[model samples]
Target: MRDAEEARTQPLGPQGRLGRGSVAPVLQLLSLALFTVVLVVILVKVSKVPSYQERRQEKQKIDKEMSQLKTGIAGLCRPCPWDWTLFQRNCYFFSQSKRNWADSVIACQDMGAQLVVIKSVEEQNFLQLNAKNKGPTWMGLSDLKKEGVWQWVDGSHLWFSLSNNWLPGEPNNDGDEDCAEFRGDGWNDGKCRVEKFWICKEPAASCSSP
Candidate 1:
């Protein structure tokens, strides 16, 4: 009886392996459950990557449909493509993908458009608001031909007096920043090779139906 009593009162050492009342096994089980829950969450996110991509594609399609022109018997009005945004009779394409300056120019050309040129104060204001919401975006301005002589993609010189929308002391050409981007404040010189979203501009497309 005394031996049994001593065993019952014995301090919990390594030899007193987990029993019903021991908290060690319970803690271990709780930790395993927590790990399982975290692992399951991670797996779920990984599995939904494709679904996220599909959802983005669907959203783009919906936007295109919503902006489509109304069909009429005599559809002679020039309108922007369903995917492009229209402003002041001009159609603009804000790229969803990021690319280097040269690649961005190629991308716009491929779409039968060119990188945007700020032709007026109205267009500048419009883009200022657009860029403020979209983060840093590349424009058609560059000084690749001659440093410090910025020109639009169309070979026209930038009129700084009329469109002096530079972010104070900008176009610094730091680290060979030959390309220009539209920021919240205005334009800034950026590295030509750095990947960034771009803007493309073109005349409104003529839509006709037989």
Candidate 2:
């Protein structure tokens, strides 16, 4: 019984100490591997942060430049010439002097434009409003080529019939009335040689710096 107690109380031998020391080395290796994995993950995340910030800043700068370009274009844009009114994409000039239809055409040509051609109700209304308190005005329309067929100075056929806006009983061909005129808000057939104020039209100038 004494021998048994001595064996149980004895210190561990070299073999047991070697076994315990080996286990400690293995545990240390495992801990080092885990730390390396964590460090790699942190480095990868930190590397992406600057790249993401750079991309965001570049996108913001591009957007700011685009906005500035649009503002510059708007600032440079001009709508009409001096003494002219702007409507849609065209510029208009109302004459203070009277001229016959043929002479009016020549005058508009000299100004690098043509007699006004009414394309829609809006344009017609605009012309009428501006011509208020003025006498009859020559239009770009005439049936000189064929008495029954009206055409604009640009040679485009008048698609809609005169009944849409003509004065009552007009174009009676009364006394060789081949040219067209605007009196008040309605159109009328008048002699081509009659003197009248007119309107000239041209495309608006390009947007540019003065």
Candidate 3:
């Protein structure tokens, strides 16, 4: 027995080859590599996220597209905007604020619409009924350009013989009244300098009612 201490050969592991000590190091290296790969994947995914400004811009673009879709040819199924009334396939807005005739015209134009255009007795009646509750309101009819020759905001001539929705003693052209106002009696030419609530009219989305 030559040196019993060295005679007891090191205990063998699986297959009695490299032993358990060598296996542990290999497993550790594999685990480290796997962890590194996972970390790298996570970093790359985080880097791909959009920035705050980029995300905001994208949202703004989507919002613009949605607005166009709501007002364009595809909007046939959509309804009138809020605070507007729908009648005869048209949308009418009754303003709560008061403004002079010129300013009222500007206000309506700013909203992508014009002052109410009363084309028929039916339209006049509709406006009259709606304005009954509200105070006196402004109409699109005016003779500012040429006295006694009334024209609509759309530049169409007003044919009194056709609709004839005017007060008996109105349009007297009293005190240089060029603008028109709608009252419970009928329409009357009023001073453009005087402020009054106005009505706005536009084509409603062509939605078929269920």
Candidate 4:
């Protein structure tokens, strides 16, 4: 009886005590899952590296092309009629002959040119310096459309305020002096019918845009 009781109290084989779990298999499975996640991350990084490299290479190519274009542009042929007096990168034709402002503009157009269109501070200064010394000279300015509001001959809004403002009480719009002229270190209304030296301007290239 004692022997039988001792035998029954003894533990059964390992299979009979399966309720107790082993950590080894669980640890191995978790390690495999973590390894799989790490492998995916590495693959994603490797896949993106080539794209980054390609983008960098494309940027470099663009930079190189821009540099080459700038270098080549420097030696590009300048516009024709290089003999024309170039002031501030613009060619000007100061009329030695006297003509009314409108007639002067028409003359310029006849020559495939336009009346001088002042565009910059340096240009205005240069024009003032190079113009006739004593007598008033007709410029590209006009107020025919809007009596008080002045505009360039090309219908562009005038921007040369500081360089060219009318002398105080000068642009009186007196019936006779409807045209404008640069005189007495400033602008003044003048007779468009009055013949006076004028200025003509041409594009660097005779080429017209479509």
Candidate 5:
């Protein structure tokens, strides 16, 4: 009995010590691996956070620039030749030489604008009042696509009753004249081939400062 108990106790001493020693190494290694995994995950997240922040900042700057552009019309870096012409949030070009309606439209498009499309009653009045000296300038209004039906070159409807700005019997589609011209009172039908002054317009909001 004494010998068996001693044998059993001897086995327990070595086995317990070995198990404890082996378990400590395994736990240490497992902890190190877990810490490495956690560190790698944190590093990846931190790196991506900066990229997201940078993109957000860039978007804010773009929004600010757009707002600034909206509030103010681009200022003149150079003097405009049409001294009497009034322009707001836009650039205007009065044709120096005469051209047919089609040619004038093409020229305006080449300059990155269509013929002038008046946006408001005030704008129409302004154009008309100034156009007397301009001698009936070609406007954006035309029946080029569909005869007898008027439409702005920009594809907007001309609600005549809103501004009520039109000459007597205006847009009569008289004869072969399909093009429209702006005068002091309002508009008049005219021949496209007829030589007259023309207006080119570009939005000021879109112009970048030099």
Candidate 6:
């Protein structure tokens, strides 16, 4: 009887515990699982940091390249050769020597350009300003193909209806006066063989580097 009473009052082993299993071992396993979950979360966050930094740096590099490209394009748009003047997308060369209109055309062709063609009031104004105090200069206009039918050097018909830079009472077709010249801020028909200073124009060359 004493032995039976002592066995009932003794502490139970793991396999003989209440309900499903031992509470201490279950608690320890739960704590270990929690610790593992926290460690995994911390490792995931740490791994993402480098990825975020790399993405940010890539974006900044792209932005910098874009900025440089914009600056390069702006530089490319205004390329002009040395000793030449830029106007819009074209370049102009003012001669320091005099030549006949025909010889002037040949000279410009040799230089990879052509005699200047007046296309706008602004261009005419610019030419006039540059011609200040200078003597009459040969232009690219002529009615050599047919009298009273003027044309530019490029074969485009002169739009007399839209605009005519001819001086008043001029182009009278007087005595083989087919070529044009700029004088006193206006234009006049003149003999092609007459020598005068000239202007040459051509498209601006593109820059090789950005």
Q: Which ten residues in a row have the lowest lDDT in candidate 3?
A: 70-79
Q: lDDT per residue, candidate 6, 1-210, as tens digits?
A: 999999999988765676455577899999999999999999999887768779999999999999999997777655666777888778988899999999999988988888988787788888877765577988788888999888889999877652466789888878889998888867888999989999899988776665
RMSD of each: 20.9, 14.6, 10.7, 15.6, 15.6, 14.8
Relative to the true structure, how large is the alpha-carbon lDDT of every model? 0.87, 0.87, 0.86, 0.77, 0.77, 0.84
Instruction: Name the weakest run of 10 consecutive residues (lDDT summed) in model 2.
Output: 14-23
Off by over 4 Å in 4: 1-83, 160-164, 206-210
Clashing pairs in 1: none
TM-score of 1: 0.62
Model 2 lDDT per residue over 101-180, tens place: 99999999999999988887888878877775687999899999998899999998886743478878876889999999
Per-candidate TM-score against the hidden true structure: 0.62, 0.61, 0.61, 0.55, 0.55, 0.60
Q: Estimate the overall C-alpha local distance difference test score of candidate 3.
A: 0.86
TM-score, prediction 6 = 0.60
Question: Per-residue error at 122 for model 4, in Å?
Answer: 1.0
lDDT of 1 at 34: 100
Q: What TM-score quantifies how close candidate 2 is to the native fold?
A: 0.61
> Residue 209's C-alpha lDDT in candidate 5?
68
Report the C-alpha displacement of residue 16, candidate 5, in angstroms.
Answer: 99
RMSD in angstroms, candidate 5? 15.6
- Candidate 5: regions farther than 4 A off: 1-86, 161-163, 205-210
Candidate 1 residue-wise lDDT at 207: 58
Q: Count the backbone clashes (under 3 Å) in each candidate.
A: 0, 0, 0, 0, 0, 0
Comparison by lDDT, 2 against 4, better one = 2
